[model samples]
Target: MSEVDNYEIVRQKLTLGPLTTPKHRKIRRLLKIFWNEKEINLLSHFGPADEYNSLKQLQERSGLPKDEIKQILRNPLRKGTISKRGTKYCLEPIIPGIFEKYFQRSRDTEENLKKAAILYWDLFKEVLPQQDTKVDNDWSLFRPLLPLEANEKIIEINQEFDVQSQTLPYESVKNLIDKFEQFAVITCQCRLVAELSGEPCKVAPSEMGCFIAGPGSQTMIDGGIRGARLLNKDEAIEFLKETEKRGLVHNAVFDKGDQSSIFFCNCCGCHCGVLFPPKLFHERGAYQSNYSPKWDNDLCTKCETCMKKCPQKAIYHKFPVKSDSSDEQMVLREEMCIGCGVCAINCSDKAIKMVKVRDNVPPDRQKIGNKTFIEMLQ
Candidate 1:
């Protein structure tokens, strides 16, 4: 087959993933620039993002020798275009998969990365804004995690079930670190893109990026993803603390919203896939924990620390009509808050505390609310 035919086939396969690749001129150019004729031909043999195929299956399908097929896959495998399971491999999705791997390559030249960044930024503008009008708006792939020191008061609203139970591992940042043995950190894909586009992040450095845990993390560490760093459980916890100090939200992204694979992203509103889109799209980007910040008027000196520190832009000073009235108070916009606990942790006077408002646990299957990974691909 011709190079154009192979690229088109690969593009269609990519569209079958959780994130769609629209048949636009920019997308076509992006695919052409990223993948060569041979690579495109090999990628055409892979299944959708969610489906894994064995080596023998790929060799047979591609009509290539086992050694040749493996050799061909080496670069793309490390590049994150193709992800491997136990003994199988499959294509990565466009956003959470290929786009990240494409830019995170530490060995790639700065000029090449910047060129790719331009295309990706354009694609993001074209695609992400449309999410605002999506029919399913209840949940996102990302969820907020409350700070370790943030106060949690279990509100006793229901009489039947016990709401006084201890906090679960998934609910608390400290516990979540303890639950994992392997941990790894990589450059923030969003901030990296922004920096490459000559718009740097004001929140945190790109190196202080996603904190990935669980058994799956070992694959990333072993794969030699450029700048991928491994950390112990204790170090991981400390790293999370630093992100909080920088006013970054701890966003836990689940693999298809299932407990199978989870990563904690220290996200900033200025350049985060999950957090920034909410500002323009008016849609919930990440799931909120059952907590909301409760302000103490007496303790608050109107320092506006919380206002400056809030990643959600949820806190603001509400000034009264009279300047001498001394009625100005910081208002907590509960509707805008993702319950990240950034404000409470940054409040020096202990004026703000996170209180349990409701319960929201990640789903067991590959579904959140009424949406499934399959539905997303569709």
Candidate 2:
């Protein structure tokens, strides 16, 4: 296609969710070129499609070379500035409010949001590289019930325990998601496969994802995931049920407030960023668990199988028995364990088991009453 035609094609594609008419694509390409300039912003305040100058008019007005004009129009940054209706170009600003409305319209109807979330999760897993291959023989860490409560209450509880703070409020999470238009669920698989012979997963993205709730400055940070929404109590329950049915495991639910407020179902690991910060500050080596694993030496056969499958590198073969003994034992370092039950499930001899050390307090109901957490954003 001609350069003009190509720009039109890109514009159409972006407008129509990557499924664009050729003409639309061309328009998108052209708009990207001039999007961020002071002149474009000035033009935006002037008027709509008919009132605003055409591409040729803009090129002449800006006094830029033909190639430079073409470059700006074709750039991805300017895609939000021009709208195509029939055969006309219109001035449109890609302000936060406009983007929010667009996303809300797309994700709020017909369960499209859910489908997008699932797709994002799938893509995340595929892109993440595997680091450790060791299996966790401990099962106790997985047994604890997931926590659900208002974001504020979680912060309070963590403080009470003297745990270093890293939790984000539900409103904050939503705002981040909304501003970025995408967010990722990052998991540390390093400890999960540490005991295995091969490399463990250094970073595994989460299968559960969320979208942002509003437009704001806090949501623009690079590490932040965008497009997050809050899930109220009922919605949180429903989300868990749906995720479970899909075979994705998660722990903890962050309730921001109302039925539609944002929530995050967290998964724990020694290497995960959320737990890492607290672990480092506390000098606890990044372990975040109330339970630890115990081994039955009598049942362990010194075959050293468990040692090969630990994700946290917590297990090792040591002290070979005298000739008379039937069992050779593997040692577990409690401090190094993250408590994911990978090793226990992988053990062939059924010798490994997890035991809970202490229980976490249940979430407080009074703090997270029935109001939309989005109200807090305002």
Q: Please report, in order, the local distance difference test score of every candidate based on alpha carbons.
A: 0.69, 0.35
lDDT string for model 2 (1-378, tens) is 643333332233232211112232222332433344543433433333224245566556556665665455443222233443333344332211123222222312334334332332222232211212121322111211222221222222322334433232322232333334333332222222121213233333333433222233234233232333444434545554443333222332223232123223333333332233233333222223443446667766667666665534668887746786545567777766655444554455667664444433323221112212232111
Model 1: ten consecutive residues of lowest lDDT? 369-378
Q: Which lDDT value does model 2 have at 321?
A: 67
lDDT of 1 by residue, 90-133 (tens): 77556666777777664455766787777777766666766442
Please give the distance, in angstroms, between residue 259's alpha carbon in candidate 1 and its true position after superposition.
Answer: 4.6
- Name the top TM-score candidate: 1
Q: What lDDT does model 1 reach? A: 0.69
Note the residue pairs that clash in candidate 1: none
Off by over 4 Å in 1: 1-4, 16-18, 54-67, 105-110, 132-139, 152-163, 178-184, 213-221, 230-237, 254-262, 322-327, 365-378
